[model samples]
Target chain A: MDAAAETTPLLSVRDLRVSFALDEGLVRAVDGTSFDVMPGQVLGVVGESGCGKSVTMRAILQLVERPGRITSGEIRFRRDGEIVDLARLPPRGPVMRDIRGGEIALIPQEPMAAFSPVHTVGEQIIEAILLHGHRWGEKKLSRKDARDITVGLFRDVGISMPSQRVDAYSWQLSGGLRQRAMIAMALSCKPRLLIADEPTTAIDVTTQAQVLALLRDLQAKYNTAIIFITHDLGVIAQMASYVVVMYLGRVMEQGPVDEIFHTPKHPYTQALLRSIPSMTGTTRVALPVISGALPHPFNRPAGCPFHPRCPDVMERCSKAVPSLRPVTPTQLASCFLHHDQAEPS
Target chain B: MSDTAASPLLEVRGLQKFFPITKGFFQRVVGHVRAVDGVDFTVNEGETLGLVGESGCGKTTASRCILRAVDPTGGSINYRTRDGRTVDLATLSPAELRPLRAEIQMIFQDPFGSLNPRMTLLDNVGEPLLVNGMSNRNERTARVAELLRVVGLRPEFMHRFPHAFSGGQRQRIGIARALATNPRLVVADEPVSALDVSVQAQVLNLLLELQSRLKLTFLFVAHDLSVVRHISDRIAVMYVGQLVELAPTDAIFNRPLHPYTAALMRAVPPADPRVRITDGILGGEVPSPAAPPSGCYFHPRCRFAEERCRVEAPALREVTSGRFSRCHFAGELSL
Candidate 1:
């Protein structure tokens, strides 16, 4: 018999590579990325606009639109005492569809677009609950049970008068309420992993604070693992226990939150941290820029994509890509500067 | 020793813009959405006044009214022209306002949407110059090159379409167009909110440099307090279409007088893991402008609300020297 997969990560993405075939050339959106999401842990994916964090997330659920394919890699996930490779599952097949929204749910950046305009928010959530009812331990969710569950989720997300709000359309509610409704929908089937992609970008700061607080509380209560993808480092600091910094479709560094923020190893990580205009800085003191703009998607640089803007670039950095190596016990970085520590992959 | 205060470049008094809420097929007017309700402020010469507010809070509406992009329902926008001639822009006719348009310009938020797709950056930046009677194409091109160079973009890229440039580069082009006419007052509405953090710092630094170089007075409307703190000499806090607190940047950040201002400060996710938004996160959504709550519009969500706050509206009054607040107990609150 196989040994228990207890010590293994809840989700292990090993050398995951996703590429989009364009008319002009191939765009490697996620080039050789790897990370682990521990059970009930908050992992933040931070990067700039074209950094491919969103594509990586879409690939996890097999939702990356065609022309963009997961060319090579393994997405090993522990499910129901068995390990499954999500990368191999047919995107439109029953198994993948079941796992997409059933076990792993997604709250998109724009909740307004994610929801249907014709249906009431409550109806959509109820439909999700009814569809995934069988997966829930013992009882199947009936119509009445689904409605009650929808209302319960609403209340859990701190929507006032959940019973009345259950009938409201997505457009009728305020931006904050719409986001809360989206959260309720995502959590309807009790997903083990919640993927929030720039979830707080649309709302006001005050409402964003409320939502972040709510998400933290719910994560604690359900002990559900989360993958939060955003461009805001401030938000990452407040939310994640571990951080994955990406640049031009690759992971530059990964480590515990404190070490990542305090003492980043990769030059890209260091430059990104120094570039931000902090609240504590002397007013009007010009912040240091990363020197050059992001390379055009089609014209991505050879070897390390960040070598052009990297302050401590070596001659060999332009020749070949460096594999991620453990710089410290808990921290990992992909840079030629740390090549002496281990053999190049 | 104290230096003399700069003269007011523009003063807005009791600005109100009401959009009617229509219901039936006949478009029967139900009520009014007082988007910018009885607001007042002044932008001194060469000073950046940061107008801070959450969405639907009327900060955007108020800035638009000042620019006359959306005509206001009432109140006067007093402007001091170059020759020391004071004019009420609110009452100016189209012909009268045409020349003054060259004196004031705007920088928009979305860099992508603001620039024309078909037109090259040269024509896009030069359009304002053309409109203001810079008829000679050669002169316009020369001036556009100078403006582009001033904003830190390579002048050669002006011939290229906007799609060829990145978000940061596009925003610089937008700034160049806004400064084409040598406008004295620039109304930048959430200019850097659409940009990435690294790029935002670059833009902020450029704006700071340009402000001193050109002696430009700015009405910087933005939502981020930290960004506002970096750029503005004074900050105004708006809630439900009314100014709750207005003070120097340091005063508002260090010792906010109003509860709403204090709450807003707490909402900004501190970039350190040691700190988190634990308590006093404002509950409930912002009230709709169409049917705002009675008395103090913020009373329903305000943690410090009392019986009196629910019954009586508070007028924006000068609380101390160079400070203003609309809260009933502005001075007494420790926050």
Candidate 2:
């Protein structure tokens, strides 16, 4: 923890904005989102579907597809005491490519689609190793060396019998094993930062526990910074040290995990927390849901995006947008309820 | 909620569903995938029984068998009809079961796929009425409008197609369709799983309200334990097509009798960050249903398995007044 306080942040995103150019108009998928990922700590980006949690992560890696573009923001990444603006790098250039897979690797949501069916899992993992392994103070690694490294990574992710299982294709493996293989591929380069985008959502609950434990262990061992993106608040609570709450492509709240769970300031964050069914015998009653559906992106409401459903909407809530301001020393909220002179009732 | 006070609304005994695995040019019967093997449970009048398990655990198969959507390989599904007649759904012929179809209906998981894209909300909700000999268009339209109002949708929106509505609204339409025939039993297979978190609560509350208002009995099958706990009176835990534990919702979460149930309870990530899971993390993947382990099916992954558990299967036995378990050391273990 002291190392995190002393050193510069591993990755810093500032006021990031990403928009999609549809025929109708521009849809701001990610708007003015900012957060920091420190060394060896997990930052959870949480929101419902269409809330731009995934888009924010994609913007960091410069992987937003065609028709979607990162219009502005600075994604400054600190590597070897040098800062690089990732948002300025060309999307498919050599420097961006090396930074993407070599310095910051990703474990995508669907392992089935991410992996190739024709090649063996081991062969694909070895290719990743060879592609990025040259940066590890060595000119190059032999095929056997890459294979051994891949096997070691497989074993690290808790895949049993890596030597034999590595030869199996992606479809031949179960959902849990395929996800583990994907994690191994992400960790093959020993990257400084890992972006895990819903990596456990596809697997079963029991396998989810194992994979989460494996990630915590690996993060502790390597001191790798992680940006864990998920819609499940339970998952965010379990895995993340700091949390970012998003809604309608904007940051609603940002704080330490404990504060976010115990003392969420924004009405959107509070309503989202209350909406989840608790497991500890406290959720048999009806959950307090945020009423009304998320407004369509094209017809986004003026002023506060969440005022339509917010329980504590004031007169000022629907007139102008609220910028994120500090509600506490370590917590920020973008709601007028926190900034008003009167106490929130 | 007493099991013996009155006859159960639905009693399923020794239900089994097996799909044949074939290979080669002749497509010979090479093996069998025992999707649901000898599962038994009962749903009382106006009560919700949650059948929960991971993917491919046969909860869906059991529900489908109860509705007779898919013919069961064996066992009896004794359902007491609305007119107070007991009929074995598994043994009934297709011709004989046509009239009984109106008494049992299913609510699917995906609202988008289950609804017809071309049909308006009224047509989708009133199709069951039309098929069941309701020829009067005014009567069906009025009933559809009332049903739409009951589900919190505007009656005027009945003319719109499914694509015009949001996911939550479409789910409401599906519920309206399920209730069109006034079913005695509603088998909702992961009804709210496809909706978002905020919308999930809305649909769940609506289901609970309708269950009470209409006096409907439900067999809710879902993988999420928390959602099941919120809506179900009792829960039956399944593993590899077998009922590992059956108890009230509180007992299932508070004092799980079966090891699998206990492990599953621990596996659910708590919404509180302070509550970290430090012990009893389950290991290994769920064994394939095509070739399950011998003796006790969960023996390979059971941490408390003994030599006897490796060689002998444990029958489902009552551990308490209402709780049941399928463990060799059911009452002995503190789990």
Candidate 3:
């Protein structure tokens, strides 16, 4: 690693690829996707369903399941003055397990399914704390100490009556409270990086706003980096500093949040932004939508996956795949529109 | 859009639907959960009325009560039929209501669960027609093919089942089924909420086009403010089993009357990143319907709530020309 790379980013992924082995053929879930998450910054990954955003995050902590393998990539994570490649780590091994929850934690989409029904929410959080507390210098926390810590965590996430709520079962709590408990558990280890996969998608709008504010407050207090993954561009604009737009297993564009929203380079990104309904004006008009749907995974398109739906598609776009090249000083887009204007290496 | 000369297509007054909360093995009724309490609104001809609220706010209950899916406890649902006949749907008998069912149809939220797995798309969409005296199989097939074409789907693909289609396509199939009877008023409950953003736009556009072509009036129920604002001519904001505000879409977005409505408008995340939400963030959750707070249901969460709002419940009254609000200081407070 270079000196600048060593001191700058907390995690850097280069040319990452992940594929699922189906009965018919190989489904490239994530193909040649790369982005970096700096310390104390939230990186948002926005995409539609089946766009491989979730698969790429799953590949980061070595959590890819059976039939899905990280084919070739370099996920270099900086830890204690050492650079470790997470792509080659065995999923269930002891070292990877320690790094999975201790250094990198995940907050899943559905909180009801993530927590156990039989156990009280407090017990589950305590179990997580005990399992990973050693990394944070809490070697021997008794049951009482762990319970106290869990209560504190619940309070931190803006839950009312933390002591009473900690003992409540997952099914007893509402959707908003269940999500808050999930956030508390994810923060139990104080992981340097948190991967929140659509954490507020299932909740109400008011509750979503509250959760987003809470996340911003917690990130400022703990100084932890975040990888927020969602399909909502509105939430992305509110939460992330840097943004990455992904299509069918590929990075369509990546840049700062302001640039991606204000001056999008990729046709897919621009179209996606135009499709969202605006709240400022009360104009009863039809939204501008993309022409076609995402192609089937098994019957993937030849070159660019979005060429069929792209409004500014060229003849060459259907025949050749364009690599991610610089569109602006801070933005990069993988489109043939910028192929000729790109600066020479 | 507010045409005073033309009568309302459907008018609901003092609608109430309460489920008894029983206790112990004997199942004795102790109290009632007022799911739809005194909701009043009107859907004019060829206009969309958006009903919006958070979860557990009784929007679904009100829609279901209007359709008589669940028998309401008390209310008058006056629906004008195609032949210019007014009928009280809430008081109608089962046999008497069977014919009117074809005039008011419902489109459910989940396309996956709403469509039967074993049935083909043709049977699913054509079943309503078959039940309503269209017994000939060939005629039913022809009509089903035409309806599918209207929804932008291939007629040949009607032979395939719901499992062979995507979420958006299945939603289109649901729309086709809802439109099979040419209903005057269609009640759609979060129709496009389950689809992706790109597909949501497609479905919204389709709904807009169908409304114009078929001259259909809609009661579009959804939680998203932007989507509701885009399709609705007039919007009704609901809170704990009550209508807090009812006004034109532009009035509700620009000059809200109720505090709850103002907070709801502010809560929606703007599409532009530079627009920051400075104030009016709602706090706490909706109170339980069984034991809702006395006086105003939203006093606990409302920022401008005063002492009068805590002691006495406010009745929904007309505040301006075409706007109504349930707040005590509706016209006084510039929300």
Off by over 4 Å in 1: A1-7, A340-345, B1-5
Q: Order of all candidates by DockQ, from best down to worst?
A: 2, 1, 3
Quantify all predictions' global Cα lDDT against the true fold: 0.89, 0.90, 0.90
In candidate 2, what are the lDDT values of residues A1-345, reduced to their tens digit? 456554678899998889999999989988788888887779999988888989988888899998999998899998876899999999999988998888999999999999999999999989888888776556689889899888888899899999998899999999999999999999999898999999998888998999999999999998888999998999999999999999999899999999999999998888888887788656446678889998888877878888999888888888878888899999998888777532122
**What is the overall TM-score of model 1 with all chains considered together?**
0.97
True contacts recovered per prediction = 0.68, 0.70, 0.65
**Which stretches in model 3 have alpha-carbon errors above 4 Å?**
A1-7, A340-345, B1-5
Candidate 2, residues B216-292, lDDT tens digits: the string is: 88999999988999999899999999999999888778889889999998998999999998889999889999999
Kindly list the per-residue Cα lDDT of model 1 for residues B58-78, writing each as its tens digit.
999999888888999999999
TM-score of each model's chain B: 0.98, 0.98, 0.98
> What is the lDDT, from 0 to 100, of the residue B168 in candidate 2?
89
Across A43-91, the per-residue lDDT of candidate 1 in tens digits comes to 9999998899999999999999989999999999888888889999999
lDDT of 3 by residue, B1-335 (tens): 45532669999999999999999999999999999899999989989999999998999999998888899999899999999999999999999889988989999899999999899998999999998989999999999999999999999998999988888999999999999998988999999999999999999999999988998899999999999999999999999899999998988888999988988888777767798776677888889999999799999888888898898999999999889999999988877
Which residue pairs come into collision in candidate 2? none
Angstrom error of the Cα, residue B314, model 1: value is 0.9
Q: In candidate 3, what are the lDDT values of residues A1-345, reduced to their tens digit?
A: 466743488999988999999898999999888888998789999999999999999999888897999999889898888988899888888878888888899999999999999999999999988888786574687788889999999999999999999999999998889999999999998899999999999998998888888899999999889999999998999889899999998999999999999999999999999998888653567789998777778878877788999999888777878888888999999998987432122
What lDDT does candidate 2 reach at residue A3? Answer: 62
